[model samples]
Target: MLGDDRGQSNLDFLFGISVFLLTFLYAVTFIPGMFTPYQPGAIDLSAVAYRTSAMLAEDPGWCNSTAAGGLPGNSSWEDHQDCLLRIGLAGDRGHPNILSLNKIKALESLVASDYTLVREKMGLNGSIIYDINVAVEMNGTSLINAPWPSASSQNIESIERVVLIDTGKELFVDCNNPGEQYNSNMLNVTLNNLTSRDRDITIRIYNLTAAYPIGLAQDPIRVVSLSGNAISLPPDDYIIKLNGEVKNSTDFGFMKGDVLEITILNTAISDPIISAVNIWANSSCMPGRPVDYVYDPVFKQKSVCYPGIMRVEVWSYAFS
Candidate 1:
C-alpha cells in the first residue's frame, strides 16, 4: 500500500490542485452582480440603495396612459397618484441625473403624507420588506428629508449620487436695455416661440412715464393682446401687476418709473405659442396706428438643471 502512493505522483497532485484553483477562480470571475445588482431586489441593501437612486435620478417616470381617466406618460405623477407606475424626478425623458424641481416638490408632499405608499412604489416592499429613506441636498440645504426606518434594524446601507434639478430659471427682459423704452408707451412681449409647459415668465417695462401725467386720460393704459391674441380677456390665464400689485385689465394707472409686470400663468394654458402680453395703446391711447414693439429675437427659454447630492438609505425590518 505504501508503494502504491507512487500512483499519484507529485506532478499529478500539482496538476490536479492547479486545475481546481483555475476552475474556482473562473467561477468567481464570471459571476455577475458582485458590484451592480440590476434586478429590483438585490442580495444586500447597498446595491438596492444604488439602484433606487439610479431609478429616481435617471427615470422621468410614467403614469398609466391607457387606464380609465389616465394621464399622459410625461404628466406629473403627483397629479395622478392612482395611476402612478413609478416616481421619478428627471423632467425630460431623454436626460438622466437631471431632476425636475416640480417633481422634487411633489416628492416632498408624498414622503410626508404617504410614506408607506412611497416605500411600496420604490420596490422596497418586496418579499424581504425593506425600508428606505431618501435625502436630497443642494449646497448643504436639505430639499427632501424622509423619515428613517425602524429603530430596531441593526444593518443599514446608504448610497449617494450627484444630480441636477430644473428650477426654471427666471426669464427677465431688462426694460432699461432699450433706450426708447423711456419714451415708448407700448412694448410687445412676443411669446410666439415658447415651448416649455411650465414656465413663469415675467416681462418688465420700466419708465412708461411721459412728460406730463396721463392717468388713463391722455393714454388709457390697457393690456391690448392678452397672451399675444387680440381681445383675450379674463385674468385667469395671465396676471397684470401695476407696480407689484395685482390689477385687472381695465385698471389703467400709468406712472413715472412704472414697472408693468406681466406674469403669464403657464400651467393654466396649453401650447401657448402666441405672444404672452402685448402692451399696446388702446384707441384712446393711440389712434389710427398699431403701437407694437416686439423684441427682435424672442427669448428661447431652455431647461437647465441645478446640481445637488441625493442620498438613499435602506434597511430591513427587524421583527422580534
Candidate 2:
C-alpha cells in the first residue's frame, strides 16, 4: 500500500513549492552580487574633492586669452577673462606642491566673475553641486582668502597641502650707485671677490617697466671684459653651457623692468679671479636705476620664496 502511494497530495505539493521558493530567496541573500554596476554619480564626492585638490596643488595651469598675448606666463590675473584652461597654483611642472601667487590671484578673480563658470572649468556640474574654498598663508601672512558660499550642508571634505609660493619679485641689480653715474663708454659690474671665476656667466637685461615688461628696449648693448674685450652671443634664444669653456648668448633682448640673469659654472675657467663686468649700451638705457625711492638689495638676483599653505574644501548635500 505504501509503494502504491507514490503521488503527493495537493496540500503537500503546495507546501513543498513554498519551501523551495523560500530556500532560493535565502540563498540569494548569502550569494555575492555579480551584475551590479558601480555608480560614481551616487558616491563621488570624495573623489571630486581629491581631484580638485590635486589640480590646484600639483598642476600648472594655462591661459589663452587675447589680453594674455597667448603667453600664460606673461599674463597677470587682471589681464585675461575666461581664458584660463586649468586652475592650478603650481608655478611649473618641475616644482610640484609649489604655488604661484599670480595664479592664485587669477583664480580668485575668476571666482568673483562667475562661480558657475569656475565650477565648469573644474569639471563640476549640477548633479555634483559643490563649494570650493582656498586659503594661502605666506610668511605668516594671508595672501588669499577665497571663501565658499554660505551653505548649511553638513557634508564637507577638505585637503591641506604644504607648498612654496613664488612671488616673482623683480631682481634689482644696481650696475651703478646713486648720485654717481657711469658714462656711455661702459657700465662696470664689480664682482668684489669673484669666487666663481672658472664658470660660465650669464647676465639677462630687461628694459621695460616692471608692470609691463613686454616692449624691448632698442638699446645697443655689448658685454665686454675688464680689458675692453667683447663676448660673442648666440644667434638665437638658447642657453649657454660650458664644456671646460665659457660659452654665452649675447642676445640679452632686455625690455624695461625685465630681468637679466648671469650664471657662471665652476668648470669653465682655470682659476678664480677678481674681474670687472663691463657693459656697453646706449646712453638712454644706462646702468642707473630709472625709478628710485625703492630701497632693497640691488646686487641680489633671485626669485623670492615664501612659505605657503593650500587648503581645498569640497562639499555636497547628502540628500542630493
Candidate 3:
C-alpha cells in the first residue's frame, strides 16, 4: 500500500508554500484599509486640487456674448460676458500656463464681489460645498490675494504653478521673443520709471526692403519721446545702422529681411518717479503699407504686469 507513495515532492511543497505567502500578504494589505477610518477612495481633496488647478492654468475659459453669435464663445471673456460658461485664468488655448492680466483682474474682482458665483463658475456646484482659495504672486508682488480659511480643515490640498503673464505691452524686443512677427512694421512699447540717468532705446524697423522712412510728418514711426515726457529728438538724435552702414537719416529708406536698428539715448527725467509711459501709434501698421506707429494699447490706464506664481488650494473637513 505504501509502495511508491513519496509524501509530497519538493516542487509541490514549494508551490503550496508560495500560495500561502501570497494570500497572507494580500490579507495584510487589504485588511487594514477595510478597518481604517480614512480610506483612499472615500474622499480625496488632493485630486480635486490638482484637477482644478490644471483647468485654471491650462485652459482659457469662454464667455458667451450670445448663443446667436454663431461663435460658441471667445477666450477674451474678461471683457465681454453675457453668460459665464467657466472661469479660467489662462491667456489663450494657443499658449498655456500664461495668465492674461485682464482675466486675472476679472477673477479677482469676481471673487471679491461674488464668492458663490465664482464657485459656480468653476464647476464646483454640489450639495457639499467646497472652500477654495486662489492667490497669484507676480514678480514677488501679490497680484491676486485671497486668504485661506482660518479654521483648520481635516483634508487640505495646495498646488502652485509657475506661469508667465501676457501683459500685451511689448517693452523690450530682443528679436527672439515668442510670438514676435518679423515682418511687423509697427512697434509699440511702454517704458516705466525712466531714470534720470541716460536711457537707451532700440527699435528694429523690420521688412523695409523698399526702405520707407519711419518719420513721416503726420504719422511718424520714429517717435523720440512720449506724451508729457520732455523728450524731443530729431532723426539725428538716433544712431541708425543698417547692413553694417551707419546713417543718421534713412533718406534712401530701409531694406528687407535685414533690419534697421535705431538707438536713441534719453536724458534723465526729474526727481519724481514717473508712474507710467505711453506712445501713440497709427492704427494701420501692417507690412506692405506706408504706415507704422507705436503707442500704449491702454492709453488712459497703466497696465503693469509681470511673471507670477499662481497658487490654488482646496480644503474640506474629513468625516469622522
**Alpha carbon lDDT of each predicted model:** 0.62, 0.55, 0.58
- Candidates in order, TM-scores: namely 0.54, 0.47, 0.49
Best-matching candidate per TM-score: 1
Candidate 3 residue pairs in clash (backbone atoms < 3 Å)? 196-268, 208-255, 209-255, 209-256, 211-253, 211-254, 279-295
State model 2's lDDT. Answer: 0.55
User: What would you estimate as the lDDT of candidate 3?
Assistant: 0.58
Clash totals in order? 1, 16, 7
Encode model 1's per-residue lDDT on 1-320: one tens digit a residue.
45654477799999999999999999888776465457554466677788888888888776766534555564568556777778887776688888887778778888888888887877777777878777888767788765545536778887888888776544444433443223444444545455454656655545433444433222222233344445443557667667767776544755457756566666543443444444454222211223222333433234545679888778886421
TM-score, candidate 1, is: 0.54
Model 1 segments more than 4 A misplaced: 1-42, 66-72, 145-152, 169-297, 318-320
Positional deviation of 241 in candidate 3, in angstroms? 26
> Which residue runs does candidate 3 get wrong by more than 4 Å?
1-41, 146-151, 171-306, 318-320
User: Which ten residues in a row are the worst by lDDT in model 3?
Assistant: 284-293
Q: Output the better candidate (1/3) by TM-score.
A: 1
Name the lDDT value of residue 107 in candidate 1: 83
Which pairs of residues have clashing backbones in candidate 1? 191-275
Superposed by TM-score, candidate 3 places the C-alpha of residue 251 at a distance from the truth, in angstroms, of: 32
